[model samples]
Target: MGDKPIKQYRKSRPRAEELYSRALESLAGGVGHDLRRGHPLPLYISRAAGSRKWDEDGREYIDYGMGNAALLLGHAPPEVCRAMGDALELGFHFGNDHPMQLEWAELIQKLVPCAERMRFVNSGSEGSMLALRVARAFTGKTRVLRFEGHFSGWHDGVGKGAMIPFDKPVSAGIPPAVLDTIEVIPADLDSVAEVLEKDRDIAAVMLEPSGASWGTGPLTVAFNEGLRDLTRNHGVLLVYDEVITGFRYAPGGYQEYAGITPDLSFHGKIVAGGMPGGVLAGRADIMEVFDYTGDAHRDRYERVHHLGTFNANPVSTAAGIATLKRVATGLPHERANRLARQLRQGMDSILREEGVAGYAYGDVSIFHVYLEAFPGSGASDRERLVTRDVNVLKGIPAPVVSAFQKMLLARGIDLVSYTGGVTSSAHTDEDIALTLDAFGDVIRALVRERVIATLK
Candidate 1:
């Protein structure tokens, strides 16, 4: 393998490197999304079709990030694209109401378990933000309880306890005062009970239903069962932020898949067919804040005034309708999860056979690769693989993950921030095999570099 020699990553990407240098002056970190940052240079994708994409340098890659989990059907899927194109020919924005919005919501309500009456928003962050506002207004409570490592979105209210230390906000812009409105706690059921009992004013319990950040730290069905009962008994609105899981896990998402319904839910990702849209859906009674027909200012706060420039725009909704129509059959879930299982199984087996002290695991289609052992983690390989420790993964040096990413690139696979990625219904058996073969190469490279120690 060493004699064969790995492809040197960037031998032909002068244009991309030049563009990154220019982009640095404009785009902070030379990338739009923070996770898009990379060493050497970010792979500037020119175009993508099906499961493969070509970067600016003309290097083809098997994309596992799948547009940050928004592309459940894969890049430039024909149906979604055609719907979006037809929408474009008609109009991109109406600014007023349109028929497509109702069609989109109806499809969502048909699929999502908790979706009764829903309002569209531009992004998942906005959906989660609105969900919390509705929960607070309905319950007449001041604070929200969210589990550590659970990412509801990039909004200020659900900011802490995700992609950052539980005690602090995800970024500095969030006012310290805002933290008072939110309480971040462990995901343990007893801890949840204690917090709910101690803080009677908690309006809702919000979390990513499939677990933190697409199951980097997976949750069991039993935990959700207890959580459902606890939240119900405590009178706290339960909100499932299914940004990455809503249409991907099953036609009805995690709530249906897990059989634990929530009071409210926010959906994005595949719900919008990778287009910029999201929705806040829930039981009709609690979602009444968005409906100001009877009166306004019924409580401490004014009626939930929710408006977005792109809310339920025709293009996004049309694409969403097409995407959800396909997801309704549950075949996408079957295909993507099967591919992921193959990828995860192969990668896990490689860690053992190649003697690397790491593991790969995820819920359904989403998967993660941990190059280091979980800290304070004496749990079995299986348990630790799904362990809920975010801070340590956050603390790993950038270069180690960068090396892993770069090496994987040399073998033609792309993962987001080297954390992990997801499979799409479009990802083929050949794609899975290619991914596993690439993983084999990268693991050897990491072992050679001592980025990952050999399994004892």
Candidate 2:
């Protein structure tokens, strides 16, 4: 609610800014990922605990971004930290299998019924890449289908259309041949079916159950169920990319919520316990393609490789196991869901009271606030809400939206500037109230500025 606008964020977080400058000399875009860049230069974090992050300049803010939806249990929860500490005492990596990996895999299998067999990887991209490889190998097909907006990961094969223009390719170095193998389909079932029918070479259909790329757009349960049946009948593997939704949605993930089981699933985020880990799990028969102990594989074990040096490293495995165990018994999801509902309700109520031409909607722990030219009463109306016309929300002509983000940032609220916010388990009732208050103040300010007119 400060009337003063944030013209620029300080570059005084010298360490991060300096590191970014140095990185630009060797790294592309001065950052590891393009999404890391935000207005006023991304603040360099010094440390984080629970629901808050302290930047290098000592500014503390309530973090709803949660490491891009990775920290479900919040940052460095005591149990996960303790487990990682114990594992570190035993050493970080090993030449072969470890008890921690098995323990984590077992826990995943127990919780996710579709995961009859599981393999850990270093990150979600790796997990997704390996899953595609396995699917292609198992099904003898070359093409993979994915929705236009959802992001699978950063691997060349699955990275297309992520942050791309109108869900087109955003990166430059990728070869056209590599992009062709990926079939981008609309979320509509008929469109998917049409593509499947036309392209018989598709090995699998990979999708995020929640439609997360557009900020927690919940897919209809029937749509998911229909896709499951379609893929099964067509002999195409159904891969649920649960990287963001896995533990955050529920203990069983979106698969459980939709009451549909995919042939293969990828997991990251919550599964990693804020470290770095990923998992691919599915039917034992389909996953057997990864096994190397068969008669024809005695010598091929070394040749037929699907391995990473840091895959299932002891520390990450321990952290994952501990985090899952804790989440299984706690109220993290319930707390997050309650907070999400509270935030959405408060935003909606404010919009109505202020006669703002916009609305907010989403699932339990995640939601999106769309500042549209007109209000959407339901899903049918949502289709008419185009991103192009939402200039007031985007604030392209001036730094209105960007300035609003900085205002919120200055007020100690951490939200993904490009997208809507997320709710974490560490968020408290007071935190929810404060966020709603901040949101109301911003909306009122926008109204005063004539950026958004009264609904009436």
Candidate 3:
């Protein structure tokens, strides 16, 4: 390894550097998403296939980002591509409805217990917005209670409390009125009950069931069950934001895995087979808010207004149907989970051997590596595996994490974020082996350079 790894990284990706220089002239902030912004430059890829991708500079990476946790079957699965091709021959978009949309909805309804009725949207953000609207309209209530760090989407209703200073908005343009209607609380049933007791205007309590940032702030099974009962008792709708967990956790997502159904749920990512689509699903009574009555007056006043140019376009629906057919067999989850387990165990071993103060943990197919400066004792690994303490899990210095990511990129392993990512059925044992080797090298190099502190 080079003494200055960042300099080596910058030298290795000349092509990406040139592209980024050009991108700065046109693209906002030289990147599409805020998280994609990397130090030096972000790696731009030319193509991807099952379990792997090639960068603009023709470097190969064993990809764990997996299209931002959307590709459970991996990149461009033949079945999904074939279905999209057939759909293209038929048509791309019709201003009218089609049979495939119904088939797609039926597939979701069959898998998800909460999906009694559904409305298609373009993204998870839209689904979250719709869920809040439907909850407010049905319950005749204006407020929503969301737990700290539980991400729903980038919309105004969910923009607050995604980060620290939980009272402030993540973005600037959101109005104060929007923030007023949303309440942020810790992920505790007692706190929830207190809010429910005092606030009768709360229409819904919505959260990411796997916990904030896809299990960084993990929620326990007991907590989920208690929240479901509490919401029911308080006459408030419980909503699940299953954008990352749907279809990947199991055939029916976390609701089925936990066996605790919510009154409403929003799904994205795998729900549309890595395509640009999302679904807002819930009880029939709550979903009837979207129905059209024959009387113009009743329809205008009572029903929710939802319109989108690409809600369930033929191509996305075709991909959804094809992906769901494969997911229903329950084979994909098994392989993904097994491979993830192998990776986590290997990573934990590496941390121990290197004397790094960190551990590997996650649920189902997801995995995370937590690096800490302190290694205090008292709890077993299982007891502290999934924590509710946000600071402990999220407190790694940004520069260190960014350097770690660059080193991993140099070694041809791409994680979704700095810490970890999801596994796909396409990932192999060989991939896990190579990833662990790369991870060990990265940790050793970081410690040697004092980028990360080893155990004292």
Candidate 4:
């Protein structure tokens, strides 16, 4: 045998790899959700505390993904766990009228100004679906307008064009006929005006106030105010899908951040404290549709059916209540913004030093890193063209991006598979420093390996 020795990974991720292989035998795509399937095998997490997680192979990582931006208070928070544990001792699931569920609803009403009344559901998808139903019933219209990049949910109705090619069905199972009921519009005010003028059957305009799916790009405050005016003028409902941005943005949610109140709002993610829960909240008059008061005419009230077996399970409600209560006073936005600025600034500096044609940007906690062909373009036309060209570059076949992610993984840093990462309150200044150091090293390695011509 030769005297040379085989190099081994400093941290073993073999158990996670093995688990994914085994999972593929039974589960489609080896995950409960399609988003969980990232390249080079998804890491199986054994346990997580604060901003760190241990993979099945016992490798520790600083988690910036943060449960797809759900872990606002970080993983396995003590308050959330304690509350849930107490609730579990009492009972997990009950009928729709559980006390903890009501408590959470009340808490949401207090935090979000527009939520005069609220209803609980099992997921953001369910909350959005139900909110749309309420909107249609209240507006007496059949169609709903949705934004190009925002994710409403996976249901057949609203899941038509979430994050895929514009105007194309994101998945195969949904029928083409359903697309007609959903009016697709870009974030631009001109597009909204054209759609609203053309489509009279539009019941509501539902969009993310902060646009989470498209790399956390925020809508201009002027655009949001214009939308509020337009929806009011047209007598249509404005539904803000605050599922991803709810508690992460601020205690009052993105509505407060944008200074525009919608007719209805759907919340999940942070509201559930990383548990399975969702809420639809809005004006009392509009929410009255879901009220089952026998005083109303049977036909009018019963026309809209809102029912779910596990709508407000006690365990999830308890976790949510604890999370919300903690965040109501804590300063997640400040901490997240600080970290985001540090990370973005560090990444941009590295890109500049390496002569890489790319940019990193985000708001508060969420951030995106995009590699492109053009380094700088100021004009709107040039910017738009650059964006389109950069998208095409991403679509083209390349191994450098995958290698970059694996390299980060090996160095104990985690990010969203696609193009972004989320920072949490649990991440210390040290964690931020460590992540920036790793990113710099990775860029240098990529350049050395000829992954790209130069960072500059």
Candidate 5:
């Protein structure tokens, strides 16, 4: 153990605790999403600005969660909020087509490499579901090949391998037959080939281009391009579920960064300017499967139907239009990525200096912090991490993560979970320094408390 005494870090946020207690009476676990459920209590955010937010007890925090990576410009960006407000005055849903949607779609087509055709959906979840349906209809295939631990959405089919143990459904409602239609495997070319060869009826191969769990499990650019080529040669449609990477990785997103175009892609999160909406964009010919006036050979079951009551609605489209216009120059992504690089570098320096067991790793603008140190393993430790069946592999113990998160909150920093965090254009260099400083303290505390170790 270290010479220092363990610091009992705790924030005075009793109001948050009370609210969570009250919420538990009405809401399940006092939270909406499963991820928000906490060990002690959930944080009740009062207000948020560019890079900071206040909890119920008026505790200000430097927020790294950034709306779960949906806020590239940061929370309540005035420009986006003004646009949304104006659109709200106009109305949300219209029985007929609106002009603002044209601006939104046109901006997307102008930037995204695979936006030859596009359709609006209510959320990233809807976007993923529609992408699969279109692929099935266009290819007449009955199954999908997905990478293990890649999250498409919370839907029954593509949601299987994301966070739950491998091959286990995310929820209880999905049937066995629904899961049997999709195949999950480790992220490798041989596995891809084996799955394709074994299952001729596979409709599409889908993945998060940035890698599973937002690059906690990183993927190589060569492998991404190889998948495109492999799928095309095998007549299997390739789909990039870029719900997290869209508008964050680059101006044109991951497809532009990798220069490997897929047949389809799903976009959400930052695309709607911190609002609720998503997109299904890709090859026009294949997307025509959603059209009614298709070829004569197209049968009823072969035609894909997609409809959203709020699809292309004014508020989201207006916010999207404003956000795309502001971000089209690519300055936001560049700034966020620059900040991310700085944060990662600083974090790595601390880990090394402190002789911590784990490392910091990620792609352009995304990063994750792994606490479980595997001694005698170098970067290969990260490579080895991906091969494990995630259902059975618990990376860092949840309790340790939760304690770290609470400590971060006490220190006026908030992240999505124990590991990685999303950077934003609004985050200043000072914010990066503060986060790094807090991380160093937290790591040292964990060491003193016997939660983390200093490798000899």
Candidate 6:
């Protein structure tokens, strides 16, 4: 629960520590992604398959991160791997349109509710950036409205309002002018109406349809439905950033799950079957901004001019096709979601029995651990906790969360962001039971070390 678990973790992964020391000379921050900048040292994974990953030191963990929620079919599923292999034998990059790209788009269009027309991009950030550009071009508006704590991506335009201390700079290099174009507000229909009422130049209203932080700040379906109505009345475009929830929520994502079709929606993660690809899709007229016409004047000035070297590359398209074909049947969703429900219920039971002041909650295959609640709010405050209050959901003490992470990691379980994780069809009943046992141990240890407060 404290330094003891960290010590054990460090002791068990000497090879990873050595690799980290070597990595520090080349990799900035001694890691590739900011999230991998681990507590004591980042884990160096050697291989992964199914629901487990083996570290460089040959330590196996029941992986709940699932390649950052991209591995809906689990790591290197045979079908996806075989597809990628066959694609590799054919060609890698064609530098021109390929038949696989058409198949990929057809599959996505078949599934996603809002994807009438689409463009391929390299990442979720690129998808969002392109969606905003299309919205502005189609609507002839300048600014965008975003809900607080909803993560779009790490691009300059959407980065500012994602983190807390909302007024402060998210990154140093972002221009003040870029920040000015984004209007941040709470996830309330009234606040949204107020903004639309005041700002006539607003281009679009964008958010994570499952709420902020991939359901960490959970949003109700009613709110999303209301927002859709409000945006329609105000003549503003509605965009859903479905990077995490793309196929994980369902074949079509939260849009299909909630039955709320966005004007534009951007997706990554499972869309490409864990490959590095994303889709920017919505209404055909809006997407026509990217289409080329015969007239030189119109083509030169009016077209969006979107370009990417690896957009819908053959290998990624193959993987996406394989994954989506399976996801279409709804079996994977059933398995993953059932396991997630068990894990959530088990964690909540552990918290209650241990007298801890927290709960486990999320939608579909996603789960979050709020290990510490606000002062004076006991474990019974489930109603208040699920109110989608960003401050309260993300307000846990850093030290407490860190301890919780270390304790769980020491027990050979890996969570996404130290708060929660996404489930995959690869996970079994045994995996869930073992995860609960590890979680129970971690919770008890946290209480023993006074890292998390206990309800009286």
Task: Residues 1-456, candidate 4: write the lDDT tens digits.
Answer: 012311244224467667877998989878987767755567788889998998878789999888877888789989899999999899787674876777888888888978998888888999888988888888889998887666788887786546546578777788777777887666777888887887889999998787637344446668789999888988889999888878777788888777788999998888988899899999999987766676658646545787788888888889999999977875877887788888888887886777665666777788776654222232222223224222242342246566677778779998865657888888888998899899889878866665644322
Best-matching candidate per TM-score: 6
Would you list the C-alpha lDDT of every candidate in the order shown?
0.82, 0.76, 0.88, 0.77, 0.81, 0.88
lDDT string for model 1 (288-375, tens) is 7766565445532557777788898899899899999999988888999999998999998987787565778787887888776323
Pull out the clashing pairs in model 2.
355-455
**lDDT sort, best first:** 6, 3, 1, 5, 4, 2
Measured against the true structure, the TM-scores of the candidates, in listed sequence, are 0.93, 0.89, 0.95, 0.90, 0.92, 0.97
**Candidate that beats the other on TM-score, 3 or 4, i.e. the better one:** 3
TM-score preference between candidates 2 and 6, better one: 6
| TM-score leaderboard ranking | 6, 3, 1, 5, 4, 2
**Model 5 lDDT tens row, 78-160:** 99999999988887778567998888999999989999999999889899899888888888888988887788889986757
Which pairs clash inside model 6? none
Using TM-score as the measure, name the better of candidate 2 and candidate 4. Answer: 4
User: In model 5, which regions exceed 4 Å deviation?
Assistant: 1-11, 294-301, 373-394
Of 4 and 6, which scores higher on TM-score? 6
What would the TM-score be for candidate 1 when compared with the true structure? 0.93
TM-score of 4: 0.90
lDDT of 4: 0.77
Residue 298 lDDT, candidate 2, scale 0-100: 51
Clashes of each: 1, 1, 0, 6, 3, 0
